[model samples]
Target: MADTGAAIELVGLTKRYPGDRQPSVDGVTLRVDAGETVVFVGPSGCGKSTTLKMINRLIEPSSGSVRINGEDVTGLDPVELRRGIGYAIQSSGLFPHLTVAQNIALVPRMAGWSGRRVRARVTEMLELVGLDPGEFRDRYPRRLSGGQQQRVGVARALAADPPVLLMDEPFGAVDPVTRGHLQDELLRLQRELRKTIVFVTHDVDEAIKLGDRIAVLGERSRIAQFDTPEAILAHPADAFVSGFVGSGAALKRLDLTRLRDLGVPGCPTAHQGEPLPQVRARLRASATDEMLLLDRRGRPVRWLRRADLTHAEGPLTEAGTPVGGTVTRDATLREALEAVLTDSTGRVAVTGPNGVYAGAVRLEGLLGTVRGLLAADRGRAREHQRERESTRPEPTPPEAEGATAGRAEGDAMGSAG
Candidate 1:
């Protein structure tokens, strides 16, 4: 609703339960900048979840401090402190008895907002998460799908317009396909909302896809590596971090890189009702054998070839195969690669936010661009190394003069003899 985000800092945060010999989360110190999404990813029992809870004091840390925008909040009243931050968890944590609107209105209403403001905020949040407010406002948690429940949970979390959000595996309970969609939705929301997010997950791929920086934790919340996704993928800090990164690091790098950065080429396109003769001429004029058909709004609808149009159909609407797959510019190269491999044409259409056709991408071009980028990065690295070496001063040793004099004396004695 508002551009609200604050930096979060954890200073030696530790959590120990009574009668336990060791702490579950020990000495976890990190800083998250405002509007940055930092993901804590590690193996099970690594205390990632425990570390996240300490930030919001869900499970208070036995020691250490929590700071929000340079203000230490650990000593504050936990109830009042929590009211200012948003929290979402797996299984949605939505109340079964409450309707969607009521669930979203909880925070704002409790914060002393007027009824009119609360109602308006509920509608705005629902729409922000892509749900029709009119239809879903009255629905309960049990009546919604797994994905829908998660959306509602997020809406409720953001209802109060909190400056920071703590999400502990919020999409873990959904199916893989739905989980992917939810991840995309979160990315879209972050683009608009820019909330300082600390996400906890066990999925490294998910971390790479969503995080501005990733903290790979070890036992007792030990941070093995804390760096950008690209840095972690290219050069892991140690053996544990390398193993956690798993196989296919190169492919994972594709996820960090976007398609728009590669500069996708445009393809021939025609409107839905365009004349067949004109479509055929356009397709022939183009280098490729296929052309994309767009509806009135310029969204991709179908793919066409000259052979499919030989029958002379009435409106070009049903002339050819449906546009089986498409990707947005924000989509990763890995996603585009998957779409390309699945398509029969060895290419995939790219669309903008409004689903309007933007461009097309091919397998060869995508791979070549990645290779060029990698080579360029290497070249820059080598150049940097050479510059550093050239600027470094040479060292002179005190013993060098004596050693040289002794060597000269030995040579003179040998010549005289």
Candidate 2:
């Protein structure tokens, strides 16, 4: 998600309940950019919920300031501020007495919208959430399924077109299938609306899936790490973050991974009309050590190693040597890794749908791609650090003789006088 310049800044935010020895949120300082979704994730009582609530003044911070869009909101009128922000919680908190349209239109009405405006907004939001306005407008929450009610709750959250959205376990109470559907719907909605969203969840997978960046919290409400999903998975900050990410971090990475970013490069091909010797010569010139044998139609027939060709009884033909197992282009890196590990050959032949050779994929190339990606990542991190250092105010250098001609002349004149 691109940062839209909308931000929620917490400056040393802390919260302590009466009689509690430890703060629910302790010395937390974070910035959630505009039009970006930042998920707060951790175990039970990690202060994720408390932190989320504090964003909209649902829970007051024990100390420090909360700023939204660069304005200090710590002392803002809670009712007025919340009315301008979207809020959704577990169980799709809809009023049973109100119809779906009425429920979704609550915020607009509260904001002093006229009847026609409210009706138009209700229709628009229901359509936005994949619900037909005509089909569900008059239906009450009690008449709708749990999933439908939650969808309506989400629609209601967007009714007023609020710039910021606070969601606390919005889909947690739903079944797995419903949750998955809602997740996809939410992603689609976010892509279109680009709301500045602060989402709190205990599910790490959900956080990884939904968040542009995740803030992983620890016990006593401490933030262990906050970073992109790929960075967090590839290089966790510490043991706590790693364990929190779980054992299948590699598999989770697949979701963020792309085949175009991996290592599969074009290789030399043998033409059908070219003589066997010509093909062999081309292979030697290419310096691949092995040549792929292609048929008259330019489809791979077999692999001919240099050693096999040197000891050949006659000119090479399709029957001379044959290739073995092949993999497809869309295969996962995990699959490619397995193929490289199990095969006797160091390289795997990548083919197309009809078994035509696409290109060659080698372990070395894969390693190279990984190394390049990592180096680029390191460079970016160093650049970011440098930028941060530059942005910080530097201390003035101590005054010294010869550094200022004026100071030296004044000192000399004073001494003479």
Q: By summed lDDT, which 10 consecutive residues of candidate 2 come out lowest?
A: 254-263
lDDT of each: 0.88, 0.78
Say what the RMSD of model 2 is. 13.1
Q: Write the per-residue lDDT of candidate 1 for residues 191-253, one digit (tens) a residue.
A: 999999999999998999999999999999999999999889877889999999998886787
List model 2 lDDT by residue over 117-213, tens digit each. Answer: 9999998898888788889999988888889999999999878888888999999999976775577678768878899999989998788777899
Model 2 residue runs over 4 Å out of place are: 1-5, 257-417
Q: Give the range where candidate 1 is weakest over 10 consecutive residues by summed lDDT.
A: 372-381
Poorly placed runs, candidate 1 (over 4 Å): 1-3, 273-287, 296-298, 354-356, 377-417
Question: 198 in model 2: Cα distance from truth in Å?
Answer: 0.7
User: Could you tell me the TM-score of candidate 2?
Assistant: 0.63
Model 2 Cα displacement at 325 (Å)? 31
Candidate 2 residue 178 C-alpha distance from true site, Å: 1.4
- Top candidate on TM-score is 1
